[model samples]
Target: MSTAAQDHPAAPSPGPRAALAVMAVLAELSFVGASMLAWAPLILLQAIFLGPTVAAVVGVAFVLGTWWVVQPPAPPAPVLLRREQAPALFAALDALRERLDAPPLHGVALVDELNAAARLSGGFLSLVGGRRTLLLGVPLLRLLGPQEALAVIAHELGHFSRHHGRLGHWIYIVRAKWDVYLDSDPAHDSGIDRLRRWIASAFLPRFIRLSMQRSRACEFEADALAARACDATSLVQSLARLELADALMRDGLRTRLHELQAASIRPPAAFWDLVADSLRDEPAARQAATLEAGSRRPARRNDSHPPLADRAGALGEPVAPPSWTDAPCAGESLLGPLWRGTFDGANARWAEQIAPAWRLRHLHLAALRAGPDPADTAIDPLQHTLQRLQADDEIAASEQSLAALRQHAQSQPDDAPAQYALGLALLARERPEGIEQVRVAIRLDRRFAVAGYGAILSQLELHGSEGELSEFTRRRALAAEKLESLDTGLWQHLLKEELAAPPPWARALLLEAIAEDRALDACWVLRTERSNDAGQRFTLNIFVARVCHDLMAADEVDEDLLAARYGSYLRTLFPHNELARVMLRFDTEVFHPPLLERFARLPGCEIRRPTRPINVDVVRIDSL
Candidate 1:
């Protein structure tokens, strides 16, 4: 939340226009405050008058407010590059920080992605002088020169410039907080919960759009700082390359990367070179690409980023990325040996995690490509698509798709994807029967409900059937509430407030189930119930602790296997079939694992705790 005014010395005070911007932000925050006011008093009053249970909810909410509870964020496939580890890289970074007069970095971590970002760690505490970390992507470093990289770094640092008003700072802070707040448990059925959610859903998204509209100058300010710190040429070139590489990665590299893994095919040793080849469009094409780079779209979502075209124009020219880079990149010059270590280790770790998905794809691909049987009704839609894609046969692909979906729907009417796809296929052919299948899909699974309902609603809207659409839209909104439950403060409050104990039948059922699995340590049952426009929502998050020597190295239990072993029986135990969900998850890393830890600390949260041969030095129940 550090602003330009705080970070930049000798910065001018806000003019009338800037004051109006600050007032606008203050107004947005007031709306949030009003929403909070609706429930916060109730929460406090309940804690004081109701019982200790409500107090627990209040404590969790307060902790969430400070945003300091989720400790030690788990960076995926992280290779922590300390100053000691990469002195040269750190020195360069330090020099850049000094030149920008930015705050001292707490650390730098390298990850395998296509971007670099300046991230404030320790959440809200970071707002009041917390640690800041810079994440450098290997692909980003691999593509740019050191000077260019610094320009990128300077631009990121510019986001923290203190020249802006305090309310402008909240545009970043509260917006990030709002994203997590959105993950609140949808199952919280209280009137207060419903009202709070109504305000958030109806208002916050639009408020975010308005806030972003007001704060675009911050992005321009960041760009200006970058141009001043480095030559405009370096800044411009870096921007162009970053945008191009990102576009290429999103357009095709992701699918290719997955396909290569599935086929056990090693990508080119010079992977960035392969990326560069796809970017080698003619000058005319490049100019067209410039206009379309994350182009100015409607501020419909919470995104605050200005379009690349706008940013480039603000920097005094349009961005035209080069076709090739022959020079030694930032990775070669700045980090040297540090870059070499990441490729084999980081990617290997990533591949290991996704091995199960890869194996499934490999099986399907190998079977179909090696002369698929004519009666192979079990053939995956993706496998068929991949095979036909080679021939560039759109007609064959569409025919195969509809056929595959029809077969799947007939074979397994309960399957959500089959039902959903079949509905889509029918709708594409202008059949009204499609909506029925979509409705069935929505009923079969909440996962399909949101999109399925959307498909139906779109058709209803096109037909000008507002009467039917209104009722259907309500159902879709309810499904949306169910879909979004994790990473929410309200959800955490629900875990503390409502889900203190499992029913006797559920407890006994869970006990009998986990008794047979030797690897299962204990299971924590957290359920949340909410009532709103969605009617009633119920969510069961079962965090299973495994008895193991090394937590990371422990074999992952197949969720379907565990569910098959226990799910049907558990379903039978449910008191009612009111949009209830049971999510069987391992106590793995997540956005707010501390919320789970809070659940564990709750009295009677564990369904059954038994003696396990756990290495005391390693896995701890408290860690959950």
Candidate 2:
């Protein structure tokens, strides 16, 4: 059978070690075979064809083979923890499980840093064995409140309840053993002999990593469980806050590295590289310094997770995070003014296109700073920073920004930009009066870009029935056609309005237009939002874009499309997805790597595998 494990390249260090081990066993077997063969006429005849040097060569190869087997074994290092100090943690998890009617937890232990993981083995209890303890990091325990911590535990429970842990672990073990038993055979002596031996040993861990990357559904289910165990509000807030902090920390690290690179007394490049390598090698340092893949970026912000804003909206809760700009300052900066000036220039570029009312808002802040007192200046930075934070998708921070804007706008009630900003905040919350508020703002200033854009998008979102969808489609097509002929500034301004749209269909159409103009990056961003998997509409948008634009497809599409396209020949090569029935109705081609894999497994899918990572093709279909 075709297997992914058989195809993977091995880890350099471990592969060589396994290769050596197999060589040792093979060398001993070879010696016995040679001894036996020396008495055989066939082997003796072959030996006679070679010079006396052949014996020396064979003996040298056997000696080298023995050395390979003597190499050290590379097992995963386990982090140990004590029980006595972490009793309260277990008590919390126990309480949570009881409330959720989940099975009793086996044990809880403290890890050194900020992380937690659950291991499940086959038994009456999901968690068992010395290795099965849920390792909670001390920093994380302190970082999250009770409800948030409960949510984390619930996520682990999600793993258990869904049988992900059991199924995944079994797959891991089987794949690992399969590699060791079957792939790393010492018999192959072709040009790819070294590469094959490496792949034979490393197939499992890499596969496990890939599986983990695709575990978003499990993560979301766990988040749902956490919401049930505690509350959605707390979990959303906790995740948002933790992700914000993680982002700032990573930014700090990047800033420090950047500074070092710019310094006059910078260390030799080789020395710095060596230091980085040394840090990576040290277990303790690596544990403390290295961020998990999760902590590296906000989950929803990355390609792997659904869009952060979309996920937050789906949960129907506000995710309030402390803005980095509004964060408390700790140290003096020698180049503070330079950074401030840089920021001013950046804001100025946007200021030119921002509505006049927005310009007035900035002018007002600048005027406040111009007052005699330095305290006024101190407040000005916070005011401007708060306004920036308000523009971002933070509800609580936006409210605080709105208050500042309202205070200024009270003296200038006709300020359309401030009113538009306020409208955005209300619309973000899906407040009852949000539409009226946008209308009020637009009445005062019809040229207000955000207000106009938000109004249209909100209308599309609320009234996508009867004739709205048709009107929207007509308007979008006409707009796309005209964008090329419009002035650069006008086109850019309209495009910004399109980008600001909150509705998925409108955004999809906007991205499609941009992609038609070869704006690949914008297409990628819009395509990322199709991870929701709501219905046929979402699929149609994504599927058409996959053909006409470049973007990554979701797991369901990747897994299902192959069989639906070519399942006739390879009846066995079908992915068992729940959505297969619905997905099969759509016209599909094995255009992407994932889709290609699925299609290749099919007996008769016609598309050939692409040399590049991304592939694109659109198949026409009359129905969903």
Candidate 3:
């Protein structure tokens, strides 16, 4: 719908290469014009006596023409997602294909937010790249339910199944990449090229804006397709939730903006002229000033998602109360009967009390027993393989896998392995929700060593220490100690988990204290590179490895140096550990909390209170 598109009946589909060719020709023309201009003074000198007025008019024309051609097009909607990380998510989309009764999408991916959009990465091969990832935002995953989550998965599938993915990708490339070519390059010259470049630079943005309007229509089409693949109600509900979230976010942001305006210490600027003056200044200084202003601001009210009211209305669906009964899920294709066995009482208890891995290992065995039948087989190894990615601390990838697992596990609540695996993921976050989830895992299987250990660890935070803990605390500590003896892996795993907790501040303090204890237990543990006694070395090695995890969690040590030290230290402590021989190991990167706010929610943690509250009024009165 751009003016150019409307005006030129046969405008070439915007493609990066096509734009680049146009830009090249424009550049060549500019170069030629400049060269001609360089000789303009000499050419005019031949007629200087008689043509002063004509030369002045020609000079003005050249300046105006130069200004017209060199303008840049709008930078494409700022690329929010990196292109490289798309492949793995794409793989998940493929794994989901056969499992869905009718595939709505051929691929999946991470985008900027919790919102899902149906766009093609490519045709027939739409499932091939990162572009196909059913992009989910981190915050979005935090809020969505199982049924709504499946609907989104189905919705994205709807795009691919309907061939929307191919067309979407084609348009995306044309709008995004083709526009890039139109403005850049240093060679080629043609009149058509110059005109095209000028048109793209000066007018294509408005044109693309209109195209996006058209794309919005396409969005509706994709939504309808998603509804057809899944339940329309589910898609409608999901969209309503998303719209509400967005509205709430905007309202909160507006409130913050108002507060900042009122709180400013400087005299308010004069209206329009002040705005113009500030706009002319350096962006770096402006950004720095804005950040400084932000630091002095108080917290604003919490916002919810856009009111689902409007979004639901858009779907033309009658508003109905939320129904939690008998939600359809995609579990059978992912985890099979092991998913069912996990929810069993005994297994749930073990999942909660012991390492979630205990249940996971069992579930793996169950899958083997079920044979290659539909009940046992998984449609997507790529989706399931997201476990490693999750373990690696990729939140988006992890959430997708966990979402799929949760969907499948619904059918097999008795699957101790599935419950434990789910619990492990939940506990991994160290949030209240995470604690509840791991708690469920333990309830299913009392002997689950991992869940037991987690519960014990959770309890220690809640009640540990001589005078502070209640009776419950004391018992939980004892239970945790009991589980601690299962294997050296438990302690190592616990330390690893704590290190990965959102903030390492408290965990670091605890680890430092533990290191002190280690030093007291054996001066050689810290001093010697390796130990001679196998039992002593085994204990020391486990502690040291945990220490490494803590330091890494705190981001206190150089990862490369720590890795080298870990290798060298382990050899000294355990010349041969069957567990040590395992190839699976954590990556070398230091894990830090993605946001500072997560620190406030750490479990079994307390922030120091001020000895006395400061009274601002009293202080001001005293100053007077």
Candidate 4:
């Protein structure tokens, strides 16, 4: 019914399908090999003249091993919306499918991001007739008006119409298999496991790169379909608005979470509505400016879809003005009269999922607020010493505070808080006893999460100064593991809480721990600390930059995406700060001409190539 439908070409070359077929064959062969390994042990037992008892034992072991190795992993359960549950929505989807001349969807679901996608399930059958599911992000639905929402749906439907879903499905399966192989415990990995890893490492990157290229092309084709199905203006506007809406939603959620935590109240039943209200209130001009600023960054090399601005540009001029019409709110339009109730139900479900994490944070805060134990005579004085050490870092003052804290701790051997205070003093003095004292405190009061933070800082300070790369890397990994073992949501809540009402040095320690874990979103929240002190602001910029760099290096997040998303905003805030300029370098390649120029312009800055390439695994300790 549209130009895109009329002009749409047949599916591309069979290269991707052939590749998927080969991979399927390899997977089958691996299963066969596993079966052979399992049967070989039983077969040998029969031929070797072993006793019936030994044969029986070997048979049992082989069967168990085979079952363990060959068992198919449970498929992730999707949050599905059945036709019966939303008859109106299903009918709308059916009409959209008819317009696109596409196969009927097998399922529809909602997710939480500001995006939509089509996915296929059920292994090799996915290449042809597997269940085709459409996942629409609830945020995206809320962000768009009815026409814009339809355009987004049409974009997703375009993928299915063009048969682009199969390659992605197969690639996802192969990559997931590789992930399982790579994540296997080293102690359990035999030669076969090593071989799997090797094969995955060799082929997975190249295959994924090719797949991404195809995905990018698929996005363009999908955009064309959307343009033909809906008016070009609505599609273009939706693309730009989607990016703005995503940013607003994320920032608004973070701001609201902080407010809720400060008020010591759980999120209300109308949480999603609150978030939506915040998004609506965001100034139109500000959103436009943000979109414009974001357009300055280079496009990400590995992103599966083309950048939003590029997509909008490709759509060209609108054929006609949008035919505005009175419509219900997006939620109501999608979910009918039950929209509000469904929204509340989803919010409640999410709350239940996160309650344990919030409970832990609340318990942590309650502990911190409790007064010093009366049994620990030294606690009050030691806390005073800790405050003095934090307030001023002058060597003489620090030494005096350290001596006072140590003396107080010695007077009350059973005081865990005093021991913890002593640990802080020792660390400020760069003494090893600080680490031991903190460990002692942790042993004394097993619930002391702050002591765990202190222990990590002490280890980082000690190992980071050793200058032995291997040891530093090992210690950093161990520290990261320790931090990771803690509940991230709890740590995030604690970090946000402390940052809101900082306790001098405690905030710095929390920031370090957050950066070490590459909690980019938390770093973004903390980076807003508007200190009048230039030095503190500079330090904050460096810390945020380092966290961004670490995320890009360790998590394989695209550097340009990080730059456009966060770096541009930081540059605007800290326009003249040298550290801000230095931080922006993370988004660019090493020895880029612009970065070199920035270094040259800075008075004391120098960029030297390392004698050997530095490993990203080594934790960089920046002085706060």
Candidate 5:
């Protein structure tokens, strides 16, 4: 699947350039508005007498506005690889650059996603000759074979060769500057500040809509470049394979997470590495079929790129079919033995980044395993009732299931499973007695994970009912301490020299309790880590990103970098999610408009947002 093209293709039409120029004008106007707001008050007061109180307020406002305008927002840091780190990969990129007549790349970075992009860094100088960084997703690299990889690289590089990267850089800077201007503090109710808000609200959305339209057009042009530079078939195959691989990777991770939780095994540090390996053995045909079935749905209106099928169809016939056996897998060929080492390093970093959440999930699972065993139920009708409670709507159909469980529990007063079922039914009904019933089950049998989970949920409910943040904080700490004490007690019991070996379930329970305690402690620590310093107020973004990393580790793919462009996207769509709510609360109470605007441009990491309002009725009792 080699191509003979040795020079860059003719540049696409200048429509996108014109669109960018308009965006630049809007950005400039925004900057002017911010400057006016920042200095206008101070300048006006200098010419007229004012009270000390009035002067002090205006001075504070001006200083805050100026600071907001001057602070530059940094992009999210990806895992960067210098040329020296992966010589072979850099060599391949250098060769591709030579063929496409593209300028040298500044660096290569890896993101945890299933896509690749080329971005220019710096300001106006960058538009002319900025440092180009290629963000490659390891999963994407692994999915494509050698020829397909080349096609994908060529496509990304095509943007630079055709000057799309340069134009995009200009647009990106202007948009950022506009955000900074629009988001400036509006504490002072001056005319200039009002004008700034008006312009931002009235004009910024239009500019964004136009910019998105141009970006979609640019994507197609880039695809055409790839077709010309590499064999068309390879590009087509790569696109199709990417769609399938992404699906398989997410599904595999989710399935494995369930298994790990069920078995009470702590997720190893190299979890992502394990995920990549699992995908290697999946049947290729099955992935293709999944893609084909999904292709039936229409692409969303706001989709940044054309559908994969459309892109493939646009490429036309290939000069020749890709010879699968002629080359090694793209990742293997490019990085050789270093591929494993690189990904292993990435996995290690990701694992450390998400350690807090990982520990929490482990502990939660342990607490669950230590609770009552539903499988111990000998009454067939009781088991059937439990199944119905799991599958049916809690508010609508749970009454009947609750009645049956209550009857069964009354009959088998000593049965832990029946009692556990009754507790769950009561919790589903939002009754206060649920917590008492769950505790009763734990008294009957301390190894009931479900009962333990129900009790924890009850605590969470009570914590949420607290009227003040200080009260909530105190309760959270106490809860965490209680969990830790349980874990400590278990370890002490196991340390006894004359003690017999614990049963497998008992061993699992101890491990889970430890994990649960660690996770709870981490969550509380993170929730309270928000800073109060004016310069450090934006620290929430970093915290949110860490949470996103953990969610990614948990195999959530819905709000990944590729899916949601930035935090604002997730904030808008999933306001009900706990993470989203956290972000929204911070945005409302702490983040100045400028800081919030900066957040809108950063790469988005999303956790699974709940589809329904987070009420007791919708809470999945079984999944807890």
Candidate 6:
């Protein structure tokens, strides 16, 4: 345990806490009462108007739907740990449970996140003696000391205190789930659905506001109980150090992962080890000072946790320093002798899952170095940093890269990719000339227009003149408005226009693109409204077709595969800098045969037929 344990400090229970707690329980009860009998009145009306049979079917459907929606999500199967496996950990939990006068835990689980939570085991039934499953995050164990881990559990278990009762706990559980779960959609506009929408949009928001107030109050109570169960000092330290650990994971891990892609390497994911070691051994003075994670910021709208600074202040002067000892981490001590075996096994599987995405990035990096190709046209040069510039590793690499981009743009004055890439590079270096390049990029390629406008807004937000942000924000808003209108116009004409033949050049390109596919169907192209300001841009919605009589043979053409291949062929048919930005729409007809049957009727759409039919001599390969 910690070197010392102070007597329970004053836990703030502002008078609003009790009132709001009562409000949340009442809100939940009100909704539950309305929900249970919600369908009865509608069914009664249907029975009076139609008949018993029709009403019976509708009532049954309603009941089944309710059952489906209310069924609690199943716990993650992979990372579940039993008491048999982690006896010491379970023993510690048992002691904490008795100390706090809480119900026995239903289960223990682990997840990939850098946080911990306690969820009710059964959906609504948890209100009546159904225990909670305490979910421990892997990072919590790997990063914290033993006493700190105990403090984490103590706080989570404090929520299950006997006085808290099943009713309040269950209400909290359902309210949390209902935040995202609503049963209303355009397809189902029945009376019950209208009521569901009302609950979601109106009653739910008010209820959330009330429950959130209660939840914040409960946090104070939980913290007090945790301080009592596992020393106050340990609790304070965990709060501070956990925040620092979170900052490290969020800021550093993504960039580190991206860097590994250069070598196509798959190292064992010892991510928690790196964080733990950093904390245990002082790495940087800057990081040591960053103990608070938005601690001064107020609680967010939906989050139950108050700001860390506020939470620490409420508990009295903090005790934890943003540092760790050379002692074994909480995972080693808490899980007893079985810790490494379990952790290493799980870590290996995580590494395996990381392989595909890691290698994909490697391939992407290689392609960038090799230069852009026909099939790689969709690969925006602006998305990637200058790989060649970084390779030189010279003091003047940034300037050299900018100079190279300038020369390329000068040589190909009309090219969009060169302009866009130059714009992106300049913006990275905080140059004003970037804006001009982006504007020219938008002119040459309408595809980059909205995104270019967004980039301009971002730069302005960072370093604009006093009134420039407001002016440019308005400009962005108008650009977004125009984009929406343009998209609407494109779709409207696409659906209603009569079938027409495509340009000769487009037909030949389509034929060349899909020559290998034996799906033996038809390809059609329809030219639509809205090109670049220079009138050089053309966005064609290409429709590829294959008619099938039986839905059972749906695997004849995989919709996903068709979308990926056909979409690529059309999108990157030519280099982005060479010609117009061509955005193609692949057919959902690959899956929806109904849409395929009616596909030909679209205005200005026509199938590309080969010009020459030659005599063919066929021979059976088996005979040879």
Alpha-carbon deviation at 251 in model 5, angstroms: 4.2
Residues 327-369 of candidate 2 have per-residue lDDT tens digits of: 2111112112232343333334333222222223333333323
Write candidate 4's Cα lDDT for 25-74 as tens digits: 57645544645563775667775897777777777776666645654564
Descending-lDDT candidate ranking: 6, 1, 4, 5, 2, 3
Off by over 4 Å in 1: 1-80, 122-126, 161-170, 178-189, 197-210, 254-262, 265-293, 370-477, 480-624
| Candidate 3 residue-wise lDDT, 1-624, digit = tens | 112211211222456334443543454445446435554775487458668776777766765665444433332232333334434333445554654434443333333344655543423223244343345543343335555665677656655554334544444444553354343441354554565566566755554544454444444544555554455577665564454344333232333322323343222222212222222232544333433332333221111112233334445564433332323222322223432332233233422322222223223323323332344232334323333323322223246766765764565587554555555555543334554555555576544533345453543342234232233344444444443333444323433333222122222222332232211111111211222222222222232221223434564444454444433333322212201211112222221223112323444222221122223222122110
Could you tell me the TM-score of candidate 4? 0.53
1 or 6, greater by TM-score: 6
> What 10-residue stretch in candidate 4 is worst by lDDT?
573-582
In model 4, what lDDT does residue 418 have? 69
Q: Each prediction's Cα lDDT score?
A: 0.57, 0.39, 0.39, 0.54, 0.53, 0.59
Q: RMSD of each candidate?
A: 12.0, 25.2, 27.7, 20.5, 17.0, 10.5
Please tell me which model should have the higher TM-score, number 1 or number 5. Answer: 1
Error of 2 at 400 (Å): 32
| Candidate 2 C-alpha RMSD relative to the actual structure | 25.2
Q: lDDT by residue for model 5 over 1-624, one digit each (tens)?
A: 333232334465677668667677666656655665657657567536776677767766766666456436657656678677678888888888886778777778877666888877755435554577898877676667877888898889978876667766666556665553343444444765576667776877677666666666677777777777677777877876666555654344554654554454445666654655655555666665666655553443234577666666556543222223424567777777778876677667666544444454454344343454555342254444443443332323335656766777898898776687677666644466876787677677544533255344554342233233234334334433333333223222322312222223333423333242211111100111122223221111112221223334354433343123233322221111112112211111221334323333332221222222222232122210
Ranking by TM-score: 6, 1, 5, 4, 2, 3
Model 6 agreement with the true structure over 141-167: per-residue lDDT tens digits: 887789888998999998777344344
What lDDT score is found at residue 138 in candidate 4?
A: 71
How does candidate 1 score on lDDT? 0.57
Regions of candidate 2 where Cα sits further than 4 Å from its true position: 1-84, 120-131, 170-214, 253-314, 322-624
